[model samples]
Structure formats: structure tokens, C-alpha cells
Target: MTHQEPPRGRRIPGIALRHRWISSVMVAVAQLIGTNGAARNQSGRVHLDALAYVLLLAGPALLPLRHRLPVLVAAGTTTVAAVYLALGYPYGPVFLSVIVAFFTAIGAGHRRAVLIIAGTVYTVEQLLVGHWLYRWLPPAGDGPTSWMTTSGIAAWLLAVLAGAELFRSRSERVARERRERAEAESRRAGEERLRIARELHDVLAHSISVINVQAGVALALMDEHPEQARTALTTIKAASKEALGEVRQVLSTLRAPGDAPRSPAPGLDRLPELAEQAAGAGLKVDLSTVGARFPLPPGADLAAFRIIQEALTNIVRHSASRTARVRLGYGPEGVELSVDDDGPSSPRAEPAVSGGNGLVGMRERAAALGGTVEAGPRPDGGFRVLAKLPTGAAGTVAVATEEEGR
Candidate 1:
């Protein structure tokens, strides 16, 4: 029963008033014709009007208030019809206005009130009018019976009531469906926002960590090893540029017009660049692949790349080891990525590897795609991170590896 506000600047009240005016005018014209007694009676004889034309027009004039005061309007129109009939007006259909009022009342959600008011009005008016008609009209053998007239009027009223109720029910159903659709859309929008936030967090955290390490390296070697300091600076430049590109790509996806060209998401294909950047940041990286690589779904591909990137970034930042090995294994069911660093476990590294936002993000990504990720310190050596991701079917496979020579 909640009503929706009409759209702004549309003048809904004026439009409704205009429509009511048009309806009243049509009904008034019909009543005026009936009042003239030009229309024939059921018995083919003209029944001249004894009621004033103004009284006949009054029924339709009351119709404009039906929506606002349903019970009162319906009763008023019915009373006017009865008065016209009692005064011996030609009965060609002065009750048309009464039908409109009854329908309007029911359509405006005043069903019980309209029924009670209409029923009372009909009973009182019918009793008084029937008695008057019985005395004033011709013999029953020559004219229509009072029972037939009353039955016809009852049938018309019932039909109008039923039609209005049906229309109201349908409008309510359509409004309910529209509200449901809006709620569902809002839920989807919220989920998308969370996803975008996670993506931005993962991308920025890893890149910034790399840049921080390289910046430290550049500052440390500035006097002792200027050549190496320049190399660290170069690594910083490349990492920042790549980070900027990835950030732009992520932001472009959120743009409404989508006019900007989008860069492809990084995957296993970018491991060489990733390893080289890590090596420049003071960690030697050896990346290798086993078995044949197959095409992965976009979500699985992005998840795999981010997991690997996060693992490598963690090793470069926390591990004391100078060398790390990354093995990429492709199986019939899925792809496996493992990063093992030859760095001894430190108390600082334990907290980060064991319980950190990086690991949690990796686990979330894997679980979202029905995959799993494992990260812990190796028994005799450094930290190791392993992830397995599913790819539904096998396709054209390729293998590529980059191993740094000692």
C-alpha cells in the first residue's frame, strides 16, 4: 500500500485533475441527455423530465472527490441518482456517474468503506424510489418490472467493483517485483565494491613493498657501490612504472564510459619480468616450469598471478637468502606454483609467513576459485609457498623458464 512519489517537474496533481475533469464532463453530458427526456424508455415511450438539469449534473460533479473521499463520493452520487429517479427524470442512465464513483472508491484502496456506504445508500434509495416508481409508472404489463431494473443495476455495480479490485491487485504485484529487482541490484553493487577494494590492496601492497626495498638498497650502496646503486635505482623505476600501469588498468575497469584501452591482466607470462625485478632488489631469483601450461580462466589466471606475486614479494622483503627458486607445474587438472627461498627462518619472518594479510589474501583468492595455497618455513631451510589452481580442460600447452646463473 506504499505509494511512490511521482517524478519531479511532471505536475502529477494537475494531470490527475485534468483527467477527472474530462471524466466528469463526459458523465455530465450523458446525464444532461437523459434529463432532456429525448432518450426512449424501456417501453418505447418518452418519459419527460420532472427533475432539474442541474440536479442531474450533480452526480458527475461529485465524482472528482471520489479518490480523496471515496465513501462520501460514492454515497453522494448514489443519493443524487435516487433523487433524480424520485423526481421522475427520464431514466436513460443518470447512474453512470454513480458507477464511476463506486469504481474510483474501490481502486483507491477503500474497498470495505465503499461496500458499506454503497450498500446502505442502495438499500435506502431503492426502497424509497421503488415505492415512488410503483405509484408513478404505468401498469406492470406495459412497462419493465422494478425487479428487472434493480437486478440490472446490481449486476453493473458488481462488475465495476470486480474490475477495480483486479486492477489494484495487478498494480501492487508489479510494484513488488520492481522493489525486489532494485534490492538485488544493490546487493550486487556492494559485492563488486568489495572485490575492487581487495584487488587494489593486493596490487599496491606488493608493488610498494618492492619499491621500498629497492629504495633502501639504492641508498645503502650510494657511496660504496655507485654502479649497484644505479642498478637498484633502475629496478625502482621499472617497479613503479609497472605498478602505475596495473593501478591504471584496475581503475579503468571502474570507469563508466570505458573509452580508455585496457591492458591485459598479468599472469604466468610475466614471471620473467617479475624475477628480474626481484633480482635487482638484492634477491637472486630462479624461475622454472615443468609440464605443459594450458589456458586458464581469467579469474583463475589473475588469482594465480597475484598469489605468486605476493609470495615472491614476501621472500624478497623478509628472507635473508640471496637465492630463491620458483617452480611452475602444470597438470591435467590444474596448475601448481611453488616458491622456495634459501633463507633461514627468523623470528620476524615467522610472524609474517605464519599470520599476515598477504597469506590471508592468497588463501582467499585460492578458495574463491576452488583452489588451495600453502605457505610455511621448510624444515631444514628457508620459507616455501605453494599454490594449486584448477583449470577445467586442457588446451594448447607451452613451457618457459628463467634460471639465474650463479
Candidate 2:
């Protein structure tokens, strides 16, 4: 149906014009051989002459252009075949070439056109050739064709169109399936890229915020407070080192899939390290645990850790408050995390950078795990981020690990 390229299994299993040429020549030769053989029995019919040969071969001659112009070729071939039959030449393999043209036309999505032409051509043959003009033609004394013979020919025409229509439906279905598969693969690829991007942003945003604060401290105290300046430089070195190590951990999974991670992903158990890091950046973070503690599923563990990490990083970058609070609660089906910072947003720090994913990233991480995140300014003059992550799914960790490898 598509004009962009020659279709497969239309006329034949090929797209090149040369294949059409070969097929046309083969059909012409077969028709010539079979018609000559049929002439031995049908001596009452018109004799084969030069014009008879030309008209007999005309249908196959037009076969080469069927893919590009099927409707015209189908109509032309059916007309030529009808004329050959009307001349009262013994009917044998003379219909072969036109049959090939009919299939080609139908396959190229011109079934309606081909069916109309074929029906019209058959009507003319039955009227003038088989009934009305047989006496005037060279096949003298020939009367109208028998009712049985007319019915059989009509059935044959129906069979050809029906067979072509069936094949067309099958090819259309296969094409549709292939398109769906391609679209699915494209969608999966996009999701994988976004997941990896979120991982990188979560890993870098916190450490970078720490490094920035420490860098400012070291610059201001270089001369007057050399001892404090040294402490600030030490914190910078530690933060950069940890950032690089975690970045390598993420990249290693990419280079070698299905292998053990160089180190396990950080979980909420590492909250003390976060507190120490916040303290180094001059923010006193208080951590609390509620309900009972249990090892969370890997998906929930990673999501909970990142949500809290991002919340703390946001406080360090956006909130003027010197103290932040974090509460982790474990329920039977899921874990809840709440991070809070007191006071209005910082003029010295910065807003969640112009186009950055801060709270949005937290929400995405939670939603991926069949959970939700809610963040807003509290009525008590502070900002709070709350997330709930379900841990009931099996193999959540393996799926996340495999995606990073890709």
C-alpha cells in the first residue's frame, strides 16, 4: 500500500523491479506453451495469428509496473484478457497473466478498483462473446455458453479476489504488530535515561551543596582563623571524595551488568553520616526513629534515603535555619519519611535552582515505588517534605539494578 518502497509478498516476495521482469517473462512463456497445447483440442475456435499472440501476451507485459501503478495495470490486463477471450481463441492458460495482475493490484490496496474492473470485464465477455456476438466472430456456429460454464467462471473470479483479500489482511496485521514493538522499545529507553539521570542528580546535589558551604567557610577564615580554615578544607576533601566514590559506584554498574555492586546503595541506616555531614556544613540535624525498625525492601530503602538526602540538601541550600529535623517511621506495609526545616527561606542560600529537580525528584522516586510525596511550607513557619514508599513488591531491587546496568 505504501509507495515509499515496493511491498513484500504483494505480487511476489521481493521489492526490486528485476524480480517483476523475471516473473512477467515466466508467466508469458507458460501462457504461450499452454495455449499452444490447448489449440489441439479446440479446433472450432479462432486460429492463432500474429495479432492473437500480441493480445495474449499483453497482460503479462504490463506486470512489471504493477507495484507503482497497480490500478491502471489491473484494469488494462483484465480488458486485454477479456478481448482475447472474445476473439474466440480457445480459453486455456491465457488468463494466467491477468490473474497475477489481479493479485498485485489487490495487494497494493486497490481491491475495490480491481474488483470493479474484473466484474465489468467478465460481464462484457458473457454478454457479447459468450452470448450475442459469437456468430459474427471467427468461431462460427458457436452458440451461447452453457449456464454451468458461466457459473463456474463467475465463481473462479470470486475465489481470486477473496484469496487476495485474505492475504492483504494478514500482512496489515503483521505490520501493525511490528510498529507496536518498536514504539514500546523506544518508550523503555526513555525511562531508563531518566532513571539514571535522577540517580546522578541525587548523588551530586548533596555533596556539592556541602562543598559549596565549606568552600565559602575556608575562603572567609584563611588569614584570621587558619585552624578553622584547615577544618573547612578537610570537610571539602571528604565530601568530594565521597561524591566521587558514589559516582564510581553508579558508573561501575553500567560498565559491567549482572555483577555485584562495588558497594551497597545507601539506606536510611546511614542517617548518622548525613547528620555529621550537615553538622560540618553548620546545620545541626536531629534524627528520630518511630515504630519498629526492619530492613526495608531495596526499592523503598533507596527511595527513602534519597528523599531524606534531597530534603537535607534543600535545607542546606535554601533554608536560613541552622537546625533541621528528620523523622523515619516504619509501618507494616510501608515506611514514612518527614524532613522539616524551621524559619523562612534563605536570601543568602538560594531558591531550588531555576530549573532543578529538588522536591520534584523526591516525588518521582516515591511514585516509582507505588508511593507519594507531599511538600509545602508548614503553618509553623518552616518547610516540610513527607513521603510514603510501599515495600510489598518482590524483586524491586533487582529491577532497579538491572536498569542501571543498561
The whole-model lDDT of each prediction reads 0.75, 0.85
User: lDDT tens digits, residues 57-95, model 2?
Assistant: 898999898888999988888888888888888778888
Candidate 1, residue 113: the lDDT equals 79
CA lDDT for candidate 1: 0.75
Error of 1 at 342 (Å): 7.5
Q: Backbone clash tally for model 2? A: 0
Which consecutive 10 residues in model 1 have the weakest lDDT in total? 397-406
Q: State the lDDT at 347 in candidate 1.
A: 41
* Leading candidate by TM-score: 2
TM-score, prediction 1: 0.68
Error of 1 at 325 (Å): 5.5
